[model samples]
Target: MTLAAGSLCLGGIVLFVVLAAGALLAFDEPGTANDGATFDAYVWRVARFTLLQASLSTALSIIFAIPVTRALARQLSFPGRVWVLRLMALPLGLPALVAALGLIGIWGRQGVLNSGLAWLGLAQPVSIYGLSGILIAHVFFNMPLAARLMLGGLERIPGEYWLVGTNLGMRPWSIFRFIEWPAICGLLPGIAGLIFMLCATSFTLVLTLGGGPAASTIEVAIYQALRFDFDPPRAIALSMLQITVTAVLLISIRMLTPKADEGHGSGRMVRRFDGRRGLGRAGDGLVIAIAVVFLVLPLASVVSSGLRSDLTKLVTDPLVQRAFLTSLVIAVVSGLFCVVATAAMIQARQTALASRHPTKPLRGLASGISASTSLVLLVPPVVLGAGWFLLLRPFGDVALFAPLLVILINMLMAMPFVYRVLEPAIATHSARTGRLAASLGLGGWNRLRFIDWPGLRKPFMMALSFACALSLGDLGAVALFGSQDMVTLPWLLYSRMGSYRSTDAAGLALFLGLICLMLTIAGTPAADRNDKRKPDAA
Candidate 1:
C-alpha cells in the first residue's frame, strides 16, 4: 500500500514532466527551447534583472544578518527570547503572500512609516515598488532565516573553546577570528547556498511586489506567459532557460555545500562572548532588535489584521470554498505521497547497497551517499516547478490536472526535507538489524514488517505531519497552475490581495497560518509520543 502510494505520487510528477515535454515539442515544432531570437530583448533584459536582483539581495541580506545574528546569539534570560527565535523560524514556514502582506503594511504609501514621514513634513516618502519593494520584502523574509540558521551554528562550538580562548589570552577579535569562524564555517556553505536558492526562486514575493517590467524575475515572466498570454511556446522556452540558470547555480552550491543540513533543527547551547565591548554591544543589539522588529512585527500585524478582518463573506464564497476543499485534498494526497516516495527512494538506495556489500563500514559509506542525495535540499521550490513545468506541459493541458498537479509538484519539491528526517533512523535500523533480517530470509513485505516498520514509528509519523505542513503552506507550483476555480489557500489569499480586498486577504491568511501552525504542532506529539527517541535525521 505504501509503495503503491509512493509510486502514484512520483508517477504523477513524472506525468507532469512528460506533459510539459509533449507540450513544448508540439508548440515549438522547429523552434529552439529558447525564448531568444524573437524575444532577444526579453531574454537579455530579464536575465540581467534576475541576476542583478538575486546577487544584490543575497549579499545585502547576509550582510545585514551578521550583526543581527551576533546580538541574538547572546542567550537572553528575559521572557520572549525563545519567542524571538521562533519568530525567525516562522519566516522559514510562512507562505510568501503572508510575508509580502506584512511588508506592504509597513512600507506601503499609507503605511505607518510613510504616514509618519508625511507628518514630519517630508516632500514624499520613497516608493515601495519595483526594485526597492522586492528588495525590502526579500530581506524581511530571508534575512532572519539566514540569521537564525547562522545563529544555530554560532551556538554549536563547545563552550570550552571560549574558556580556552580566554585562557590563551586571546582578545575578542582573535576569538572570533580563530575559534568562532572555524566552528561556523562548515555551516556557512549550507546556509548561504540555501539562502541563494530561495532568493533565486522567489515567486510570489516578486509577483506581489514587482511593480513593473523593470522588477520582473523569471518566475513572474513565466506566470505572465501562461496566465496572461496563455502562450505555451513562450512559457516552455522560458521554463527551459530558468532551469538552465538554476541548475548551473545549484552545481556551484552543491560543490560549496555537500555537508548535511542538521544543526539548525536542534536546540542551541548559547554563550556570552561579545567580540568587543561597549559600543559593539549596542551596535549588535541594534541589529538584532531590527531583525526582530522587521520579522516579528509584521506577523504580529498580520495576525491582528487577519483576526479583525471580517471573514464571513469571503469564507462563504463558492470559489473560496471550492479552493479550500481542493487545497485540503491536494495537501493530504501530497503528504501521503511524500511519505511513500521517501520510503521507496530510501529503500531503492538500500537495495542497491545491500546487494553490493554486507560489510558494515562499506554499507555505512554507501548509505551516507544515498542519503545525501536527499540533498534535493538545495533545489528551491520555484526552480523545480519551472523545470518540470517546462519539461511536461507540451503533451497535454496542464490545466486539466491543475491543483492536484500542484500537490504532486510540491511533494517532489519537498523531498529533500522529508528525506533528511528519515535518513538517520533508517540508517540506524539497517545498521543494527540488517544482518539478522537477512538471516531470517525476510523478503518484500516481510522486510518492511520486521525491519522498517518497528524502527520508523516516530520518525515516520513526524515526517508525515511535517510533509503535510509543507504541502499546506506551499505556494510555488500552485502559483503556476492555480486559477479562478482551482486556487489553493495561498493562491486564494494572493488573489484577494491583488483585488485589493485587504480584509478578506487578511482573514484568509490567518486561516492558512492557523492550519499550518496546527499541523506543525501536531507533528511534535506524533514524534514525541513514541517511547523511542531516535536521533534527528541530518
Candidate 2:
C-alpha cells in the first residue's frame, strides 16, 4: 500500500512534466522566429550567457569558500565560532528577492558604497548590476554553503593524519598539500557542480539584478518571453534549452563526483599545531572577519532600511494584506503536500530495506522512488511554469489555475528537502521500534501515535516548516503565473522593486526575511546542534 502511494506521488510528478513538455512541443517549432530574432540565435545567446554566469559564479564561490572554510577549520575555539557557522546557514533560508534587495541597499546607485566612495573622493563607484551583480549575489548565497560543506570535509579528516603531519614538522603549505588539499579536493567537484546548477537555474537574483538582455540567463529569458513579450514559442525554446543545460550539468556532476560514504565520527576534538600562532593565525582571523562583514552588511542594510519605511501604512494596505495571506496559504498547503509525499516515499523505502528477501526489482523500485523526488530539482521552476502555462492556456484563463499550479510546483520543489529531513528520523524510529510495534499488534495510527509520533514529531515539524519557508520565498513559479488576483509576497515584492518603491520593497523584504528566519530557526536547530557536536579534527 505504501509502495503504491509512493508510486502515485512519483507518477504525478512525471505526469506534470510530461504534460508540460508535450504542450510546449505541440505549440511551436524550434527554429521559429519571435520579435525579429531567430529562435535558434536567441537560444544560443541565452544559453551561452547562462552557462558563462553559472561557471563564473561557481568559480568565484568555490575560490572564496576555500579560505573561509580553512580559516574556520583551523580556528575552532574562537569567540562566537558557533554563531559564525550558524550565520553561514542563514543565507540558505533567505529568499533570493530579499537578499537581492539587501544587496541593492548596499550596492545600488544611491547605496552605502556610492555614498562612501563620494566621501572618499573616489571618481568611480561600483555598480551592482549586470554580470558583476549576478556574480556578487550568487557568491553571497553560495559561498557560505560551500564553506560549510568544505568544513565538513575537513572535519572528516582523521586525527592520526594531523598527528603524523605535525610530527613530521610539516609547514602549512606542506600539510595542506599532503592532507587538507586532498580532503577539500574530494569535495570540490560535487560542491562546484551544485553551485553551478543553482546559478544556472537562478531566476530571482538574475531577474532583479541582471540589468538587461546583455546579462539575461535562460530562466529570465523564459519569464520575459511569457510575461513581457507574450511569446510562447520563444519561451518554449528557452525552456528546452534550460532543461538541456541542466541535464548536462547533472550528468557531469554524477560522472565526475562519485558518492562518498556518509561519515559517522566519534565526537572528540583533535589537537592541531598548524596556524596556532604568528602570521598564519592573523591571516586566518582576517579571512574570517572579512567573510563575516561581507555576509552581515547586507542583512543589516535590510533591517535598517526596513525599519525606516512606513511599516504601519504598508502593512495596512489591502494589497499587501492579500498578498501576505495568499503567500501563507500557498506555503502551508505546499508544505503539507510535501510532507505527505515524502512520508510515503520514506515508508516505502524503509519497508523495502527491512525486507527479509527483497528482490532486485523491489530494491530498484525503492531506489527509484527515493530518487524521483530529487528529479524536480533538474527541472527549473520557470520551465515547469512555462509548460503548465502552455498546458492550461487552451482550456481557459491560465491565471485562474495559477494558485494551484504554483502550489503544485512549490510542493514538488520542496519534496526533496522534506524527504532529506524526515528520512533519517523515520528510519531510526523504525529500526528501534518496528519489531516491538509488530509484536504488540500495533498498526496504522495506533503504531504511529504510540511509537513513531513520539520520536518523529520534531523532525516532521522541521520538514514541514522548512518546506513552507522554501515555498514562501519562491518567486520563480509565481513570476510566470502571478496576476492581480493571484499575487504572492515574492511576486508582490518584485513588483514593488520594479515600480521603484524601494521603501515598500524594503519593508516587504524585512517581513519576508523575518518570517523565513523564524521558520529556518525552528527547522534547523536539530541539524545545527548535530553540527556543533561534530568531531573537530583540525
Candidate 3:
C-alpha cells in the first residue's frame, strides 16, 4: 500500500510538470520549416538574462552566508540572540509579495533609508531598484537559512569533539577545518542547490525590485505572460524551461539530502566559546549583531508603520473579517489532514517493518516510501495548484473546494519539514520499541500506547505545531486557487500591500508574525528539550 501511494505521488508530480510544459511548448509551430530562423530572439534574450541573474543572485547569497553562519554558531544566545535566530525564519514564511513591500518600505525612494540619508545631510544616493536591490534582498532572506543549516551541522559535532579538541590544543580555525567542516561539507551542495532553486523561481522580489524588463527572472516573466498578456503559449514555454531547470536541481537535492535528523533542534544556538575565549567571543558578537540588524530592522519598520495606522481598520474591514474566518478554517482543517496523513505513514511503516525485513522487495519499498516523502519539496506551489485544478475541474466546483484544496496542497508543502522533525524521534521509538514488542507478543495499539506514544509525545506534538504554522503562513497554492471568499490572512495582506495600502499591510504583517511565532513556539521544542539527540546526521 505504501509502495503504491509512493508510485502515485511520483506519477502525479511528473505528469504535472510534463503536461504543463508540453501544453505551453505546443504553442509554437513546429513545422515552421525555417525552425531555427523562426525562434524568437527576444524570448531567447530574456531567458538568457533570467538565468544569468539567478546564477549571480545564488552565488552572492551563499557567499555572504558563510560569515553569517560563523557568527550565529557562537552567539545564538546573547541578550537578543534567541530573537535574532527566530527572526531569520520570517523570510521562509514570508509571502513573496509582503517581502517585496517590506523591501520597498526601507529602500524605495521615499523609504526610511532615503529619508534618513537626507536627515544625515548626505546625498540620497544608491537606488534600491534593479539588480542590486534584488541581490540584497535575496541575500537577506537566504543568509540566515544557510547559517542555520550550517549551524545544525556544527552542533551535531558532539560536545566530546570540542573536548577532544581542547585536550589536543587544536586552534579555533583548525578545529573548524578538521572537525566541523568535514561534517558540514555534506550539506553545502544541498543548501546551495536549494537556495539556487529558490532564486531561479523567485517572482515577486524580481518583479518588484528588478526595475523593469532588463532585470526580471524567468518566473516573473511567466507570470507576466499568463496574467498580463493572456498568452498561454509563452507561459507554457516559460513553464517548460523552468521544468527543465527545476527537475535537474531537485534531482541533485534528493541525491544529497541528509538522513532524517529532526529535533527542530536549531533553536537559538549560542554555544559560546567552543573555540577560544576572547577571539571566539568577539567573532560571535560581530556575527550576531549583523544578523540581528538585517533580519530584525525591517520587521521593526513593519511594526512601527503598523502603529501609525488606524487600529480600527482590522475590526471594521469586512474583507478582513471574512479572510480571517477563511484562514482559521483552512489552518485547522489543514493541520488535521497533515496529522492524519503522517499517522497513516507511521502506521504503515510499523506494519511492514515489524518483522526484521531481509527481503529485497520490502527494503526497496521502504526506500521508495522515504523518497516519496521528499517529493513535497520538488513540487512547487503553482505547479501543484495547476495539476490538481486540471485533474479535478471536470467533476466539481473548484471554488467551493478552495479550503480543501488549500489544505491538501499545504499537506504536501509541509511534508519534508514535518518528516524532518518527526523522523528522528520516530526512528528512535521504532528502534527501541519494535524489537521488545515483537518479543513480548505485543501488537497494534497496545504496543503503540504502552511503549511508543509515551516516548514520542514531544516530537509528535512538535511536528504537528510546526506543520500547522507552515500551513498558516503558506501563500503558494492559496494565491492561485483561493477566491475572495476563501482568502487567507497572508493572501489578504498581499492584496492590501499590492494595492499600496502599506499601513494596513504593516499592521497585518505584525499580527501574522505574532500568530506564526506563537505557533512555532507551541509546536517545536528547542534543542535543550531533546538532550539525547544522537549527534550524527547524514
In terms of lDDT, which candidate is stronger, 1 or 2?
2
Go through the candidates in order and give the clash count of each.
Answer: 14, 0, 2
lDDT of 1 by residue, 1-538 (tens): 4334434444554455555445454555454444455356786688788888888888788888766776766534434666677677777666777777777778888776788899999968867788888888888877887787777777666666666666788866787688656656676777776677677777878888888778888777877776677665566666666766777777777798756433332333434555446876666667767777777667786788887987787678887788778778888888888777777667655654656446765465445545434333333454445545555566686677676567766776666777888877787888998889889998678888867788887788778878887787777778877766677888888878889889888888888877777777666543345556322211
Pairs clashing in candidate 3? 24-236, 76-270
**Alpha-carbon deviation at 455 in model 3, angstroms:** 3.3
Instruction: Pick the TM-score winner.
Output: 2
State residue 254's C-alpha deviation in candidate 2, in Å: 1.1
In order, the Cα lDDT scores of the candidates are 0.70, 0.88, 0.68
Better of 2 and 3 by lDDT: 2
Evaluate model 3: give its TM-score.
0.79
**TM per candidate:** 0.83, 0.95, 0.79
State the lDDT of candidate 3 residue by residue for 288-365, as single tens digits: 677677776676676677778776878688887787777777777777666656655655554456567547665665
Sorted by lDDT (best first), the order is 2, 1, 3
lDDT for position 334 in model 2: 95
Off by over 4 Å in 3: 1-46, 72-98, 124-126, 156-186, 207-213, 254-284, 349-361, 388-401, 435-452, 526-538
- Give the best candidate by lDDT: 2
